[model samples]
Target: MEAMLEHHDGIALFTICRPEKRNAINFAVMGALEEAMEQAAADPQVKVFAITGAGSEAFCSGGDLSEFGHLRGTEARQMLMRMGELLYRLLTFPKPTAALVNGTAMGGGCELATACDFRFAKEGSRIGFVQGRLGITTGWGGASMLFAKLPYGRALDVLLRAEPMTAEAMEACGWVDAILPAEHWHEQWRERLAPYAERSLSVLQAYKAAAGEKWRTAWFREQFFAEIARCAELWGSAEHEQALRPFLCKK
Candidate 1:
């Protein structure tokens, strides 16, 4: 499976299951994620929705360049818009959401974390918004979400630096809610999330609705779509193509 969804103890854990590719998001993975989210949302027993990757080496590397690097022009725009929509849905999801960062999370992976209401990262994990390294801005509405969720300077630092930051550093910047011990992180996350999961679904949904109200505003949606469009334009640009060569060659 490119992705797997499991329901346990009122939590729906959606895992990206491609350890060999660092759990990167490919088209099939995207579809699976969407389906997982839908399934969790419709299940009355599911009080919380969470995401994670399959293995210890990486939470997610980002979009799979091996599969997506060949896309250009409208193809790129459509792909970016699809993921952007998914992230937006996650940000506005009625249930409480979390990202369990077991290892490195870069580029769109960081964006995925940003979309969640809380982020719990392993002690040794690293996180970064590194789309700048590819000569494009975040196409999944991650940058806009980061700006809304974090202080301006800190959000800019993560995006502009284009380098990975340790879990401690991300915690310091308020991006990470907690840093779990590297050993038995799955058990630790389950323990940590238990309290939230125990809450009534109505209570959790009400709080999430209030917290995500701004994301539903017309202004925010306009700005987010604008960002996605800008990124799509850059995705077809000479600079982004040139920057992607080194990464693609490795594939």
Candidate 2:
């Protein structure tokens, strides 16, 4: 399975399971994630939802270039919209959501982590919102979420520089809530989430609702879709094609 879902002890764990490809998001992975998230959200017993990638080498590298890099115009638009919708759902998911960043998270992968309510990183992990390096803006509403979650200056810095930052740096900037030692980061995150998992589902939902109300507004929805549309238009641009060529060649 490209993505695997496990529910146990009132927690739902979603693992992106393609370590060889750095757990890049492919169509199959995307579909599985959507389904797993739906199941977790609907299950009354699930109090916490945690997302992580399979190996320590990477949490996720981004979208799978081999699967998506060749698309253009309308096809690219559809792909962007599909991913945008998925991330938007995650951003507003009712349960307490956590991103366990075990290693590198780049581009859309970083966006995926940002969509969650809290992010915990392994000691040496790194994250980068590098979409601009690909000649496109964030297509999954991550930029919007960053603005909502982090200080304005820091969010602007992340978007403008398009460079990776160490987990330590992110923690210092308050983007990552905690940084655990690499060897036992998985256990650390589970402990962090344990308190929530023990809570009643309604209590968890109420806590999420207080913050999620603003995100659920129609104006925010417009901005999120607008960001997707903007990136989709750029997805077919010559610069984007040129920028992604070397990566596509590696694939």
Candidate 3:
């Protein structure tokens, strides 16, 4: 499946469905998510949106690294811009949002979770930013959001190191808002959101919109444009290609 969007009560859940590849994302999945978010925004019926992967294995592993070899420099930049813009939209979305961290959330997967307002993880989930080992920084603005969400030193430790971090360790850094055993993730998540769901949808949405609007300012756009340029240059490099060799066959 490209992606799945389902609604229960006022919450819309989006799932990335390619578990065989650990839910790696592609252009189609991105577009499906964008469309789902747009629909949620337009409908008065939906008040909360949550994103997660389909399997118990991963939230989102990252971009499909295996798919990177075909596009060079400029084409690659266009792709980055598209995905970055989508994440920006999600980050600034006008309703309550959450990420169900079902398992390992790496690279773009981590970025997707970070874009949401709340990240609720399974106790067993191991979250990390893997871009550094790939010879790049976070490509979809996950780093910027991570910095905003985490305390100064903790943010540095996680984003800079780009290594595996257990749910408890991440919670210590204020990365995971709430954690429960893997089997209890769904029940805990729905319960955590129950209070917000009780409020009038309009009121809840207005509060959500106001908070996001405060940061959805000029500077966010500026950062995005700058990162686009950086990613474009990085995509053209021999070093990045070399580091990505195992994941990408250089077709």
Question: What do the candidate models score in CA lDDT, each in turn?
Answer: 0.93, 0.91, 0.83
**Which candidate has the top score in TM-score?**
1
In model 1, which runs have C-alpha deviations exceeding 4 angstroms? none
Regions more than 4 Å wrong, model 2:
none
Clashes of 2: 0
Candidate 3 lDDT over 58-142, as tens digits, reads 8899898767555787788888888888988898888889999999898888888988999999978999987787777777887
**Residue-by-residue lDDT tens digits, candidate 2, 105-138:** 9999999999999999998888899999889999
TM-score of 2: 0.98
TM-score result, candidate 1: 0.98
Estimate, for each residue in 47-122, the C-alpha lDDT of model 1 and write its tens digit: 9999999989899999999988989989999999999999999999999999999999999999999999999999
Off by over 4 Å in 3: none
Return the lDDT, model 2, position 82: 94
The lowest-lDDT stretch of 10 consecutive residues in candidate 1 is: 126-135
Scored by lDDT, the top model is: 1
The residue-level lDDT of candidate 2 at 184 comes to 79
